[model samples]
Target: MQLGCWQDCIGAIDGTHVSAWVTGPDTATYFGRKYCHTQNIMAACDFDMCFIFISCGWEGSMHDSRIFNEILINDNVTFPHPEEGKYYLVDASYPNRVGYLALFKGNRYHQQQFRRSQQNRTAKTSRELFNKVHSSLRSVVKRTFGAWKNRWGFIRDMPRYDFANVQVLLVSASMALHNYIRRNTGNPTTVHLICDEEEAMTIVNAIPEVEHDNDDLMVGDEDPQMALMRLRIRDKLVYLRNNGMLENI
Candidate 1:
């Protein structure tokens, strides 16, 4: 659960597409990138693999960024708001705003990619080091999704529920059940055990350092202030790395 220098990070945010059945005028809307009817489920999860917030029922074809923006616009207060100087770790698909930290776009960021590249040598630049750490920490959300789908067959291959209400009900009930199990009997370690030993060790040894590669930076449409905040945070991460403090974490 240690997020290295990002101790103020509360959780991770990502979207998962769940297959669904739809008809009539809504059929096209639900047809997603997978070439099937689905629901783009936006979820936030803590380090323990427990979901903190979930927003379901968006069209499968909708972009993840769009869904997140809609959530902020429609239910800003209800959505989990990070405290001052706190943020959530999000993937490149999300905007690098004050409340959310995103990985450097066009950089090596996936766990598999990092492992492969690191096999030869460690990260060479600050951005590479940052991405290495970012990928390792953000993997919790991916594992959470895997564990969730493995446990609930209904969500894996959702039956043909003709009504949207029924589909939403099923989705909500499944998420509730997931939380209940996690809170009661779930072992956080077991969720991560699905990975092989080498990969696990890679994550453990991923102590990031700062670099100076700002080429093709993807800051998205963030306002100037938020963009600067993001840069400051990255600089802070680099500072910690160079000072040998990040390794102790």
Candidate 2:
């Protein structure tokens, strides 16, 4: 968690799709990428490589920011932040919110810098070294997702359960089991989660409901407030891009 020191460390936030086998005339609803219905799961994991919170069972149709608003931000979860304040890492798809920090998108320079830092190799400067070390620490949670899906086939292919609620219970049980094994065995490398954005997007975009819609509009047009909110986020994203704080444009 120490990027030069713990002061700059924050947990990373990301989501993945968990496939589940569902039934009824709603069978089409369960068919997700590669022919499966995906449940979007989000989690926050600290620098210690431990999970702070995890939420799942969201229909694949929901956007990342909307899920964060409903499950994490509005849900009233709190975390201990460094002196600078609490922050979480998220992707470009998320909204520009107050409590979390997002990686910048659209800048090749920043992206290259980040990629080099992520490798955790020796760097010329202390700041670069810290960035690499800190990024590696946050990578544990991403690995967890990989282990969950690969080791537990139920996650890769939804298990046949009597009800969707039961399917959820099974998923939770699998996660709990994963935690138990990791804690008792003291093995951090037991699982590996795929971090490739293209792979993730393939599954996420497979959902028919999401494929058909581009915006969250209730009617033909967005409300003024909603439009403004979108504009504000866009501006903030641009600001982050202009600053070296974010790497994407």
Candidate 3:
């Protein structure tokens, strides 16, 4: 909502590869497209950059869609089921299912960040408006991940530790402490590491080297109710923009 999204936009969800040093046979399982031993850490964070949910300990080779489906089916996962009419922003890699909003398929939407030349990028249609708004709001998770990694040097140059403890201790503890600093501070952004690195830690699929998966995307069969919700949101965003209630972004 802070990014001009509707009140129903609760937060953003995405997966990141936490670099690790695993021994022996586990190296093969942990090696991903980035050519490093990483554990796929799926997390959800709100506008305040607090990780409200985290599912770690997955192999880096595992696809996000596969992990997401597994989390849904597995009764053990305490996935925070959103209240009715609320949803979390996800990327093209995730399915457009209930409680998870994604970009509108077949639309020419903006990427993670905009260039100076693309500043004039406007929504000519309702679908474009929805796409623009959704993409902007969904970027919170990327920014949160960026700040988290930047604040903790250990995540970048990880030291040797038990593979299981890497997820439970380092990953979870970092996020928990990140939340503490973020919540306790007046300006959390100011406390972010004074580094020269990029600010947005986008999903791997958004990277040029890592290719996007074709199957299980939003283009496939999705929840009928969610499809309708997307339509309504598209129309609503256009309406708000036309009346000057919403910005062209």
Candidate 4:
């Protein structure tokens, strides 16, 4: 939960692809950075591995930033707007807007990259250091997706539901159940009620349906105020690291 200098961090936002079954001839619309046909699901997950917000039913080809921009601009979507000083950790693929903090640009990011960089030296530039710690804290969203897919095979492999049927709602429904399960983790009765995957799917299917739409591109322009905010955070992080005060983070 400690996000280095991002003390007001509420959670992380990212996109995940779940296998999708397409019937139309233009299946290319459903293929993105992934080779397989999938639906891009944009989610915001807190440190507890529970989804707080999500945007689903996007075609596989849509970029994460596009989805983010679409939701933010769409009047009907009603995003869970962060508080005045709070923000969410988003990867480089999304825009670093007012309430979305991202890793420093044009520097080392990702765990594996940092691991390789570490093998060569013990020292790191401020940008590299920030990216390292930023990626670490942002991993909660990925882990949340992993836990969701691990628990529900249906999410990993869809049963070829129609486009207008459960397919539109599957990702959100799964996440809704994920949050519910995470909230009641210690309750034996909840465990017993959802232990079976089929029963869990049945429960998900019973929830009221939600729908979605598509949008256009979002120009990746860094906001000046957010840029200054990141600079301030970097300065604070440097101070903490220099003083050996970042040990708790």
Highest lDDT among the candidates is held by which one? Answer: 1
Error of 1 at 115 (Å): 2.7
Order the candidate numbers by TM-score, best to worst.
4, 3, 1, 2
C-alpha displacement of 29 in model 3, angstroms? 1.6
Model 3, span 127-212: residue lDDT tens? 77787777766777888999999999888877888878654478889889989988888744422222222322221112233222
Candidate 3: residue pairs that collide? none
1 or 4: which has the higher lDDT?
1
| Error of model 3, residue 89, in angstroms | 1.2
lDDT values of the candidates? 0.74, 0.52, 0.73, 0.73
Query: Cα miss at 92, model 1 (Å)?
Result: 1.2
The C-alpha TM-scores of every prediction are 0.79, 0.57, 0.81, 0.81
- Which residue ranges in model 2 land beyond 4 Å of their true spot? 5-8, 24-35, 73-84, 109-138, 188-249
After superposition, the stretches of candidate 3 with alpha carbons farther than 4 Å from their true spots are 1-5, 112-120, 188-219
User: What TM-score number comes out for model 4?
Assistant: 0.81
Quote the lDDT for 13 in model 1. 95
